[model samples]
Target: MADNEQDHEHTPLLQDQDNNDNEQHNHHDQTSHRNVVENIRNLIENEIPNGHHLNSSSTPKRVHALLPRLFTLINSLVDCSNVEDEVVTDEVVEYLCSLGQEVVYGLLRCIESMVAEGQRDVGRKRLLDRRAEITQVAAAAVTKAFVDKDRMGTYCHVLSRPYYAVGEERNTAENAIEIAIRVHATDFIADIEVQRCVQALWTGLILQVEEDESRIRFVEYGGLRRSRRGLLDWFDIGRLNVPKYQNNMKIALFIFFLAMYTFVVNNQSPNPNIIEWLMYVFVCGYIFEEFRLIFEGGTAFFLGSIWHWVNIISYSMFMVSFSFRFTASYILTDKSKIVQYNDIAYDLQALLAVFLWVKTLSLLDGNQYFGTMVMVLQKMLKDGIMFFWLLAWVFIGFLQSFFALQKAETKDFNAAFSLLVRGFLQDPDWELAEVLDNKYGFWVFALYLFLTSIILLNLLIALFNSSYTNITDSSEKEYLALFTFKVFSYLKSPDQFPYAAPFNLIEVFFVIPFTPILSKENYKSLNRVVMGILFWIPVLTIAYGEQKRYEELTGTNDDDDIQGGRRRYRHLTLDDISVEDLFMIEDVDENAAAVSGETAIQIANGEEGAVVDASFTGWKSNGPVNETFADFQRRRVKENEARAKAAAAAARAEEASSSSDEDERADAAAAAAAVASSTSAGPAMSEALVQTLLASIARMEERQKEMETLLKQLNVPTAED
Candidate 1:
């Protein structure tokens, strides 16, 4: 009865506990819902001002301010585990999409920053977990904005919004790289609608500008419309003021000329053709463009770029080649002379063509793979210059020696230098000895050959190897520096011409004229007159010419034809063909088995070591057997000791021989002194002194023999013994 009473009391307690837990869970859910709504409301209020649209210039600052709050909310939603949380998150994203380009850009940048930071912080689990969702939502929002606008120009303009444009953080390379990474990670290139959009924006970044005016113009006229900003602005040509854009425009014009040159080369006619007339026009345009670049940038700026020099030399050659070709076809009446002149011109054109193509590599200096190769080659060349100087000094020494010794035969320094070069090439002529009558000539030649061939040449090889290795080691850093320089140049460039020349030239002539007229307050009628006169002719001509050409080339009647066929070519090799024509599996196995059997037989006969097993399944030892560290150390020590003993014995023998030479010289001096002193005494006294000296010399010889015997017993060989 007491146990039953206790059970009834515990059951009531359990029921009360369950009720309290349910109430707390309900309260938490309500609080979360309230927080989500409150945060969303606050974000919208902060980002959008009264009486302004989301795309208004004033909204970018407000949107920037709202980024931190949005990131906080994204973090909170990341750990959310129910359908309600997903619904709230989707609503937040919908609000984000409505706030326009700046907001969407900020949201992407925030996610990128979170991801970049998460890699370094262990406590950023929410960021890591929701990264994919965040990226997907942000990408979808950006895509929607792009579609809604229908203009890649507007989209590209939106992407140029700066995060921090007025502080030390402004123009930061890391910030740009992060933005690029975010754009690349979206895989927007796969989206057919935005492929051109992505490419134009990426090109702007590569040019190191906020936006490329040429690219913007290309997009605008190429058929994209801006909804808020209106379709056309004559004054927008002011963007062409940027130097990088001007440079790019120049490159495009050069490429066009190069294409014309290619067409002329392929024409195959001996006589002048219509293509040659077009080439004259292109050459004139190239000359004008080159001079404009030179005069605009000034002498220092023009000379500073290696590409400029390349351009100058190539154009000069092109001019000469064209002149020669013209003379050969028109003025030169003799057939043989004409052929010779034509050959010369062709050779010059070929050389110029090589240099022109090589200059194009500078355009890809921002690409990692190509840039790395260029940088490595540059470093190798820089270091090789120093090595060249050292080699030159040694070469000069040999050159002068040979020139002086074989002056009669060589006739001049050039002839002697030629001979020295032959020696360097390891083709020294022994027959030159007969021409060099002086005995000293042979010894000098030997010394020159020894120094140049054995020491200097090997040193040059070592220097080259070291330079190549060093360049390879730092290739990554060099590429990064090049990429960063490209970004920084764009960021620091002024808002100016975002297109290259010739193309930019059109804007200069046609567009700049209308800027002043459009800016005036009361010139509506005049503006219309100017627009009709300036714009319609070019626009209509381009449209009609393009349409006519398209119809002619494609043989299609449809005005809105979009389908274009790509030319395809297939390459076939042995591996691409049917296996039956080559070898069957049975035949391959038999050949492999036979080779293995032969190898096994050689190994068994001890003709060769077993480098491979008979089955050809695994490696076998052909090198020396491995030794333990301790055994290796012991062997090394014994070898060192033997070497040291040999060295010591040689040193002692050399010292003993030197001492014997000193003793012999001292004895001869003593005998001469004694004879001089005895000369004054008498003939008999001198004779007695000589006999004593002879006896002493015999005694010294006997002592020398005893010393030799002792040295032999010690196994230390003396000079004579």
Candidate 2:
């Protein structure tokens, strides 16, 4: 009976456990089935556009239409947190590949709409809202697909499509550029894939601009005539006003006019006239513009560019030349001083011409053939500064030594330094040595020659060679980066009027006043219409008068019939360039090796090596003190225990000292109180109390000494003791 009762009790508990397990299993199955149904519903909702419905029978027939929608849905679902997201993404990508051109076209259209919408107020707000909730994730996904190597054919086709209808009537190159600029301005600009796509598009555009024969045409009479559409249209005042390019053109024109002025001033007598006044106006305008750029950028920007300093120096010389010439011609009364000032002015003008030519090197910095050499030269110049710094100290040492030893023979410090420099050049004047007649002078001169002429010169040559070689190896990449920066700088420039001096004045007088009153689109149209009207004056004049002059000078119509003669003077562009032709650095590993080599060289030269922490590569932890996390933890624990023990011992000693001090003070106070009370009572009471207090005081002192001894034994000293 007992065995039966025990079995029955255990049976009920087992049954209860079985029932709980069944409930859990059923709940799990229901959740899994519900998840499947929800996934299918989401897939259908996302893949099919609104107001569209499809049954299983129609799904097969609509697969073509569904493919793009499916890709778009997959792209949107990229940020969704689910186990099937990656699998779905891969499926969508594969499906896109199978669909080919249709899918690519759909993606491009999607991107275009997105970018166009993003540029508008209401559309931007909508996109911002969607982005806040991580909706509409298709842009980055589409960009990724477009940049793939296998999809290069598709990318090229889309870019070469020639028509982008962003509410524009005519299809033009500007429309294409607008699309590219919009895409570039988006969040995907940082992606390497997006960068490549944009770069390729820019390259194609640049090539088109360069090879565009529409800018020049043969005239019926004979001489070449500039076409209605010319290269300047890309940077026209009424078009995308890129200030950097406009400034470059203005500077070039200023230089030309300045040269003409210099020639005229030198060739003719200084007389006030219309041409002279025009020259003055141009000069003043150029100077004002230069200063405006300088002040706006501030000192750091000015000092950072070597070209800016050159500009400053050239401008200063020109100003001086102008002042001297003006004073000599108009203000001065003395004929001799006038002649003297004129001569000074001529010399200053000549020096300014040289600096001007040097400044033109900056304009050629984008040329592929010449740009590398210019960059190498710049690098060499920078490295040469340090070499000169070391040489300066050596030269000073020689100067001091020679001055001290040859003071009697040399006239001054300048004379002695000149002599030392001459010696370094290996052509020392033995007469100076003979005049000095000092043995130490000869020794010092010999040492200086050995240090500077042999050692320092060789070291400088090696440094220059190394820097040149390194720069040359990476010159293509550097030049490409510089060229891209120049292009982007022009594109991003905020200046609305990108015209040269007199023309800029027209814009300031007419265009600027109307800007606030009109919408940007309306303003651009009006500005273009006005600028076109103004431009025709020059165009007609050039076609008639200049062509006639050219015909007369050539004496033959055949020679003047050539088109594109003016094309050679325009800016450099990457004509006929392939996607693969873009230059990029490919030697990242070599950079680390170069750094190691530099460090070794510094050590070899007995110079202090720069402190470089190896933690950048986790090498710092690989040294003699390499320890695991467990080992570190154990060490920290032991240190913490030692600190705790020290603190506890100090606390105990303090407590003992404090207790002993309190006891001594209490005993002394008790004795003093007893004596005071007895004195207040009477003479008989005072005599008895005094005897008792003295005994008690002696006992307290004895006890205090004993406590002090005990404290000493315990290594815990009290203040009184």
Candidate 3:
């Protein structure tokens, strides 16, 4: 019925297209939807070169020029803003899907050959040579197009509501996080080319913005309909914001909370003290947050993670222990009952202590390396679980065999289980010889040892090794992905208004009850006032640090000269050292001058984007002036952002036009919109950068002149003439 109804609904539109084609051409032409998509696919395939055909003339410079056009074509496929869900044409759907597939295929081809096709080292060693430059730049651009939405969350924007204005259409559509998971699931994480691309993307995407101003400044917040700020600007202090990055202050706050939790858990008694009671308040709030997370992330997501499983068991135990402790202290009348409840409570706490502290290691997510290590360990633990399941059945079978070998009353299950375990450990209890003197018992026991000890043990070992290798490469990508998950899942998890734990209890009890009765503005005002009072510490601390960072960033040119251009970069070099008698660091002018001079010559002579590979390790060029690599990467990121801005502008321009020809309209709009977006994206290009662009153009023009002269001298006809 639904299919017939849909066909009836769209029949007129289909008939109109059919009638137009019937009159216009007798057959569809290149201007048709299929042809347009095929053209775009061909262009995408050509950019990848060698994979589609043996074209060797493609260069990084050419890719850079064509990439912007490709993006504009893609963005113009479906007018996301005006396209209604029910009315979306299959032609537009095909175009969108085709673009995504062609882009992915191109990226795979580029990365796989990136290293093999490119190499040419000079006096100074380089990670990637000039030939591989196109591969790196193209791959980076593709990765950015896909993942830029991840950064859009930081803006918490007006333009990106309901869905991002750029790359989204429907509320029911799923975001492509499963791409990462599937890559991980299939053990494709170990592919070196893939990891290299991941590393480059990681180095650019995260290392640049991990300390961006996410939790500073008061601003309007929430959805289009339910948005709020405080009643007055002064009351609009940001106390509920969560940073996308794991900044120093956030790490410090987490450590402080954990420390307090640890102290209370170690020292608290059945009759809780004031401090212990405070900790209980915090625990209650934490469990509340977990429940909220379960609701927001969905039951499947919550249950899928092993950490959540641990959380469920631990929280259950804590609740049970609290019930027992309270019963023993106040409710229980009999002394014997009270003592028994007390013992049970202590035993449960003892077990919970093991769970909580061991889980703490997994929560040490401050460092990227730590996050990656935790991921590896978690994957291996999953592998170990499977082996244990098989081991359990094998052990049970052996125990049953021993039971049948002896008199029913005399069969000691514990003794047999222990003996089997010891034998597996290469120390068979020959003492069990008296119990199992029969040949059948002897042979079955030996067979059990061979199966469990030799075969199963080796299988488990091999599985663990495989799991390790699967996650061996791309640690930085894995780390950033983990943190991004935590941001979307827990820190920025669905809460109409967020309050950190302990303080959250007040919001739950007092604020939530009044929300239905209160007006939106008044509700927000209450939250603002309450948060301004409760979370003064985070607000004040982050506010001061943000202001100080701003001040430092706005330093004079003289400061830049003295510090070797440390603008926007936080890497510490010898110039950062302050001690007068510190001979350990090379802060003196002579060494600094030499390093800077070397880096300058390298940049002037070489033609490559910021490349991160094995050669980047102990890169001597990074030791001094970081202009050679890091600054190049920063410029690349800015360039990407500029493209996004340009696309958005072009989108508005295209919408304003009445032309039905999508491709023609996009080209015209992009030409008009590029000037505005480029100017607004960043500060004016430095004179040196302008000179470099001019020189590059001049060289290209000179080469073109040479080609024309050569062809004319050979009496060849020119296409232009």
Candidate 4:
């Protein structure tokens, strides 16, 4: 039993010694591991510092320190380990990767400090130098650590190209977006939304590229591709399109003119029935848009886009309506089975062609081919008389044909009968039809003769003469007298300002005088009769009024009063009148209404000096029987008239001079007086005059107070009254 107990105690002591040995080995192993960790930490800290100062010298030190850590990170991530055990290799890689991350973090903090200091110093020669240095070091380190250098270079190259996004101008954001788009770096980008931004930029860039190409092509070519081509090119080249509204208006105006010409000429066929005028009216709504800006002075631009579709539809409707009218009318009316007015249709088609030309105006620049074609007829037919004559002849032909057809129908004439009658009318001699056909020929030849001799030849001469005489006149006067009154009618008046010319006595009086006569509807000799009446009415009325007035006052029935009107008028001109005693009209005697002679001129001239003569007096002493009386009478009349005339003339001169203020003389006088006053005044003398004036003012005030008290008793307001 003792031996067993001793054995148990010895075993326990032996077990405790083994446990202590194991504890010591474990402690030694832990200490060695701690030493290894510290060595590794020291090595990492020596290579990568927490802070770095910004300088040329600091960069090399940073690069050298960062390289080892970068290599470690790469190798760790690559799992470059010689261990055959898969688990051990993974564990080693993870440990090394963690270490490398710490080193990388420390190095990055150092670089950040360096960059901050560099920015603060402004010690670099240029910003680019600072940026280049910082970027080069950072890029080199990042490249060694993680980024593939080849891919980054390609990315940078793409970023250099300017690309526009929302705005038309290419900018930095757009270039960055372009790089993202080209590289398909959507997944790599920090935010997914950036891809949409990149796409938008790409779309804008594509449009720009197309616009630039278009401009280059246009310059290479001789003609413009479109009217807005220049603008689009500018937009593509990153320039703003100016007066965009006006440009659009010009295009619309051209379109309007084309539409008008087509609508007027192309639809004139005597259709089976013309399209309802309502359809044309409705169609005019579209034509309205084309001209809306014209009435507004062609200043709107984008307004065209708002109604572009409407304009096109309206114009198309008009074209269709007219086309149907021409086709139906010609088919139904043709008796010969051949078109009667084929030439007319051809002319209509030619005019219709202008609409296409006008439409093309918007697409082209530089050359104005489309606009020219649309307006070509305006230049050719600008002569008003020529156009009027042509229109008149067309009207005459249409009227005669229509009347003839009606007459034939009344006589129960068929096509066969008409043909037979036509044959019978083809006689060689003494045939009325032959004479009418050969001589009249639709009245065209007669129209030509009348138009050339009367309208064109005479009016052209008159227009040139008037224009030459008034070229430098006031613009308002020229337009009012030459254009509105002479060529057209009273329609242009509403456009002029109320103060503008032709707001004159002549226009007011003469405009209404002959309107009723001119508007009379007489044929054959209408104009000749009208013009003759216009020329003579005023003259005859004035002469008759004078003659009757003279007869009434004198109670003399004398043929001499009526016969010698012109001779009396010349002798009693205004120049013969003396100025002092102005003559004016008085009440006319009712009994003298039938009297033969009176001249307003004699009254005016006689007012100067002459009085009624009781007995006959000679014209001069050399010719008459009562020589002494005539000489005395003439001397007295002449002396009184001379004095009166001088006084009246002086008054007239004063009135005329005062009518318009002369600014030059007034300004000169004012300037001279101002200089004199300034030079004459001085400080001390001015004060003395002021004091004397004040003393006199004080005395006047005292007297004024006494006068006011006295006036109060009389209830009068006055200075001293």
- The number of the candidate with the highest TM-score is 3
Off by over 4 Å in 1: 1-305, 326-340, 389-397, 408-414, 422-474, 484-721
In lDDT terms, how accurate is model 1? 0.48
Give model 1's TM-score versus the native structure. 0.37
Worst 10 residues of 1 by lDDT: 614-623
Q: In candidate 2, residue 351 scores what lDDT?
A: 74
Error of 1 at 172 (Å): 23
Indicate whether candidate 1 or candidate 4 has the larger lDDT: 1
When summed lDDT is taken over every stretch of 10 residues in candidate 3, the lowest stretch is 613-622
For candidate 3, write residues 111-147 as lDDT tens digits: 3333343333343213223222332333334333322
Q: Candidate 1 lDDT, tens digit per residue, 1-721? A: 2443333332312233433434456776545433432322322333343212223342335555656655755565555422232333443544454444454456656666766776787686454636534554554445554444333323333443344422323333233223533333333223322333333333331122223331211221211111112223212232233233434544566677778778777554666677676666566555656676565434543454455677788878878988988999999999999888888877887677788788778777756788877766555555677767877898888677666666564456765666667877899865564355256666766777898788876876776677667656766645554444343334333333332333334444665576676754334344334444544443344335434433343333454444455333222563342222122232234345664576334433331001221110111111122332234345435434433443343343333434557465345535443533334333332333333333334445457779889999999978865
lDDT of 4 at 643: 35
| TM-score between candidate 4 and the true structure | 0.18
User: Global lDDT for candidate 3?
Assistant: 0.47
Query: What are the per-model numbers of colliding residue pairs?
Result: 16, 0, 0, 14
Top model number, lDDT: 1
Q: Which should have the higher lDDT, number 3 or number 4?
A: 3
Q: Which ten residues in a row have the lowest lDDT in candidate 2?
A: 614-623
The true-structure Cα RMSD of candidate 4 reads 50.1
lDDT of 4: 0.32
